[model samples]
Target: MISSANILFEFICFVMALCFLKGNDKFTLFTKLYLGLVCITETSGFLWMMCTNKSNIWIFNIYILFEALYISFGLYHFIKPFKKNVKPLYIATYLIFIAVYLYGSFTRGFFKFQTTAIMVASVLIVFLCLYYYHNLMKSDKIISIRNNLGFWWVAAVLFFYFGSTVYNLFMNVIFSNKPFAYEILVYIMLTLNAILYGIWSYSFICSSRHQKLLTSSY
Candidate 1:
């Protein structure tokens, strides 16, 4: 269900998607489309849970599929230019993530959380983001971090996934044992969503300014 914290996160993402319409970077637009899908899924889940008063696990089960795909693709898009040799590895990791997702969905069924898939995807994406950072630090050319959209975007992913590692680990345990853990989960989610969407929104704005600067230069 939609919480007060996540609504702001979704709004920022939506506003940033509209901002992307002004820029020429198709890759940025691609991420924006993914963001749109995320918002749609989240809203639908909220409405489903609220209206029916039933679990919306299935909705999120389906969402995790697209989440892995889009984030992997986005990572590939960001890292491809910098690390050619890692191209095959990125594709392989994405395929592996899909395999894991399918396995979890079919075996565990959609009525429950895709815990295994989420955990695996989280660890894999963190590694990918770490690899990107390593390459960025090693690059011969000097660049200001302020101008690096990819850095901010990847950092957002890293922060969210890495921070959620513990939450993912204890997700089932908390729900089963701690009756009042919803508040804790809400704040954790709030922090994660804020960090993820906040950095992404800033990155889009940077991309916009970059487009303008390049056009002015030309």
Candidate 2:
């Protein structure tokens, strides 16, 4: 019987396929790039875990590097649609994250530092999203669009992603001896991530439609 993690991985792959087929045109070029990276990282991580039983530590290390890169780029693009100057800062942060990931991968003692960095980045991204939502809420031009979809979608994604990270961190630090418990936590996180991506794809679709309508009206 396929485990829940396997099932969730399959579902994530299926959703990614559907997103490529149906929502490719809706996403911005940056969004597309980040999404592609995310798909690669996520699938590889899942496969590595399932096949190697955490023995292939290098794969997990690479996965973490790629995931941080993906998140940094994703946030960059997500905000660039409104805040352009922030791109450079995001790039700088990404480089720092990459360095940290590399160090952590090579040195077991540094793993805790990497986890802390990831948590900090995640929190910063959530704050950025909230700031964007606040500005959009006050803007009259696209108030309806922002209110109806953008803000909520961003909030949902941040909530799940951050929540999962917290749980995984706890499992890693506090329940290190319980392998099965750690596996379950990872499975839950993967499922939440897949759901978050689906919501992100839908939000891209909505944003595309709204933009087209606005252009046509003008």
RMSD of each predicted structure: 1.8, 4.4
Candidate 2 ranges beyond 4 A from true positions:
1-27, 45-57, 81-84, 109-114, 138-140, 146-153, 211-218
Residue 10 in candidate 1 has what lDDT?
78
What tens digits encode model 2's per-residue C-alpha lDDT throughout 65-171? Answer: 65666556656655665665987867777776666556665775532435655665566566666666766665555556542345545765577656766674775
Q: Write the per-residue lDDT of candidate 1 for residues 143-166, one digit (tens) a residue.
A: 667766788889889999999987
lDDT of each: 0.81, 0.58
Candidate 2 lDDT (Cα, whole model)? 0.58
| lDDT of model number 1 | 0.81
